[model samples]
Target: MHIRRLAAGLGAAALLLLTAPAAGGAPAVDPVTLDGPGQITDQVGALGSRKPDVEDALRRLDTEHGVQLFVAYVRNFAGRGAQDWADATATKNGLGQNDVLLAVATRDRQYAVSAATDSGFTEDQIREVNATAIEPALRQNDWAGAAIGGADGLGAVLAGDPVPAPAITPGPANPGGDGGAEQFTASDVIIPVVAVGGAGAAALYLFSSRRRKRKDTGGGEPAGWGGDGGAPPVTPLPELDDRAKQLLVETDDAIRTSQEELGFAAAQFGEATAAPFDQAVTSAKEELTRAFRLRQQLDDAYPEDDATRRAMLEEIVHRCTEANKRLDAESASFDQLRQMVTKAPEVLANAEAAAARLPERITAAETALTAMTGEYAESAVTAIAGHPAEARDRLQFATQHLGEARTALDAGDGNTAAVHVRAAEGAVDQAETLAGAVLRREGELREAAAKTAAAIRDTQADLADARGMVTGTRQDESTADLRGRIGRAESVLAEVGREVAAGRYDPLSVLRRVEEADAGLEEALTGAREREDGERRASALLDQALLTARSEVDAARDFITTHRGGIGTRARTRLHEAERHLDQAESLGATDPATALQHAQRADQLGEEARRLAEDDVSGYGGFGGPVPMGGGLNTGMLGGLILGGMLGGGGRRGGGFGGGFGGGFNPGSFGGAGTTGRMGGGGRF
Candidate 1:
């Protein structure tokens, strides 16, 4: 009668529930589908009381942020792993971008949270949420808590908000009582027992027989069975065999070599002066002692059981490995210490010398800035003012750091002193750069102003000579226009001289305007000469101008091509423009000699600008200490304005993310979640 009842139960269970298909077979159940926004399906009824809360969280997330969330619980995954099952389920359901699926294999004791590709959650963030919010609840068998907490945490992360801490329930030390009977629910035992028929029954009978035998012998099951039971016989580690002896010999040789190197480093660098080297030597000595003691222990514990001998050998091997690692680290540290010690005196001297010269350099830079501002009230003088101010500030900073470094050196803290010295040196370099830029700019302005003035004077003299030759000659309408233009050019030249004397003009702009006036005077003079001496003289002047322009253009082109790799995009563009202007000049040289000369001159100027730009790039200063003209008016406010503008204009956007540091011990890349396919997220074990 009992056998018949068992057969009936098996038949009924088989008809109601089928196992998942074997590998290479069709799936036993249809793929899961997410039918609603807040649906939480519990195939195994694991999330018994928590389904409503989980559903509410999912609905809220979807409504607020358009992030879809799905949760599921199943008894088993058949033969499919949790990761594979979750991926297949998500694909079959046509999960859209930013959709997230959390699947739990209750019987398999595994879970996976799969996210769509466009989800904002990063792998690190997802891992943190799971470890902090969901895993704690799962550990205490609170399935409902896991689902609700996980949903809320994920929702918070997706919304760019902080996740709330998980609420944990305290449980007894041991949930299973001390009676030692294996606990099983009806569903857990009956389903598996019925699936395999009498074979399952025979396994249960054998387990019962083993328990009876253990009870009769007064021997509790094993130590890990949650009962006060006798431990199984421990295998004694083996004594030092030939292999162990050989390792010990090698370890001793390594220790001796390390000691020799340490001694040499100490002698060369002065042991009394090298604190790190002394400390490392002490540590290496202590580690060697420990290694020797471990070897001796293994050697003395002879004639032991095979297990005991093996254990002893393993301990010796561990000690030797650790000792070797320590020796290597010590050796490298001592080598660095030696280099630092040898260079300390020279570095200190150089830093002291630089500090001493800071005041003179600062004063010189200030004088240059003052002179620049007095001579030119343009933006270039204002821009140049900022460099001196920055230099002064950096010098002060360097002084402070240098003082600290000296104090540290006096206190015999070489390592700390070295750090301060390096900082001081960096500050000094920046100060020098700033001051140098000011000095260089002032020199360039003076040179450019003088050259432009000279050009204006020479062209004015030439025009006067031409005007004398045409004095009292027969004048036509064209000659009348030429005379009027010459008068205009002279007026502009006087105005430029007045602005320069008042220190209210930009050097480059003044240069440009002066050059324009010179060109106009030359053209007017040329027209007058042509009327006096015919087209032959006019052609001669045009030919001379064109030759000069061609020579300058050729030089500029050669310079640009030679430094092509170092030139920037702006300079390259200017060079191409120069080429275009040159081509135009060539096309018009025969038809309009005067116009062709102007075009060629313009091309020459552009080529010179391009060459200067390329040279600045090659020098690594990016025109910082180069002759590029800055053109704004100068005043006390201008200095501050220039400095502020430079700071803001040079600033660029920076990107970064949060990172965790060591707590109990060293941890690297261990806190983040595992990255999943098609998702910006990761997972971790509970």
Candidate 2:
């Protein structure tokens, strides 16, 4: 499982680090509630008690060591590379420097650790941590151990302790303990060599003319040049050059249209609501600009390489294609937001309802604020001191907008009324948040004070647990960090307890201090387990990809072998290419799963084509002559695993086909939410 890595590695936390922003976008992931300073989202379940232990360790990592670890366990990577998915999650979460994300898509049997470019851990350190702590436990199907190991490993690095060494000692090769490689038959060794040689020879033959025309041949001019040293035909669409130019112009017009639409929409739905659409249009324009630059370079006076021009031309189309895709992804949402202009009356009603609630809400908020002021010290109420004033200002703003809305409605301008309604709604919501904040603050403080008392007890228990893990303690190097932690917790909690009882303090602040002061303990977040006791590892997605490819290839080969007499060159040729690609995949599988996946996918595509061609050839043969009675005892063993298929109608092979990841079927969900103050960088294959 070769995983592509992503970096949140924090609040700038993760996203796919790609030169071209891999066309895939993240899935519509419902937001996870990140309450703790450090945490893990165990979406695959099965962690039980270990989830908290691991989270406590992560909290310790952050509180004590100044590093945050954001962990996620998804069912699978699904629509994007591990790195891309990981990065997107991190970025969406808005994790910052000193924060790192440990994303485990165990169902896919792949993991990626992402950190910001400026994170405390280096690339080399991340690699070390994964090898020594993460992957070994993963390979053993120990999810809890993997998570704990990550915490333990990162903790060691932060404490300036030696990071653990690689834990994967290669096992006895054949289980015979002779230290030799696993046994394979002579044919196993022979087939790939013959396949590679055959494929290479065929490709060389088919591409020879283009290859010869590619560079300056032995002759000073060049062999096989198409007059003005034209690019050798690469794409099947000969009109691609014309198509590229047309797409570029069309996309540019689309971008301009978007900009104009954005202007109109921004007035109704403020800049914040319109920001994503603006970003999409900007990104699309940048891509279009790059395409134009490529086009300009292509038509320049300088002598260009034939391959370079062809590549640039293809790239022009690709750039335009990507630009169009980005725009397309946002079009519906953009259009819907704009359509809100027609819903002005509805919007105004809602805004008016919000305004009506302000008077009682503000009075309740101020009354609540005043009652607390007398009982608690001013320091205790500092957080909400301005909450009432802020609520008042927002109410004033809302009233102003509400008046504008009525005026716009009188003028029969729905768009203007919609704009006023949006502003009034925002102002009212802010006033509500401000009022709610003061009311909620009272409950939060009382809750925090109670929690502070509990935290003290927890700290004491944590110390006992710390001591319990130790035996006949001479406090060796291994236990030194824990020992130091216990000593520090004991000293800090003593002072904290005395101060908390003596005078008023921010209970939330005290809790954070206690968390930092204490040794590791339980995390409070109850994760939403996506699967009830799922498997140790997800069925390997890449393995499934390969299996499907092989099925398609085998089906095609069997059908062709059964009807070789009727099958023409097209079907046989496609089948040969499929076999060749499959062979290449097998050869490369051990070293490169990413590229192996690509070849396997190609094999699947070609095999499908071959099966269709073979079916057509067999069916057309029936029209030419009466069906020959099936031969009874033809030994098909030497023909390489032939099977009875397609009973003269579309059957077995038709039901089974494999296809590509396909033109980035990424429908990205909305990105902003609570606790998501992110600025992290991107990700890639690890």
Clashes of each: 19, 29
Per-residue lDDT over 51-83 for candidate 2, one digit per residue giving the tens place of the 0 to 100 score: 676777677766665566778766557656677
Estimate the overall C-alpha local distance difference test score of candidate 1.
0.53
Best by lDDT: 2
Candidate 1: residue 410 Cα off by (Å): 4.3
In the range 10-112, model 1's lDDT, one tens digit per residue, is: 5565544433111112223334765554457666566555567667777787666555677776644556656677766675654533467777655455677
Residue-pair clash count for candidate 2? 29
Candidate models: Cα lDDT each:
0.53, 0.56
Error of 2 at 125 (Å): 62
lDDT of 1 at 650: 19
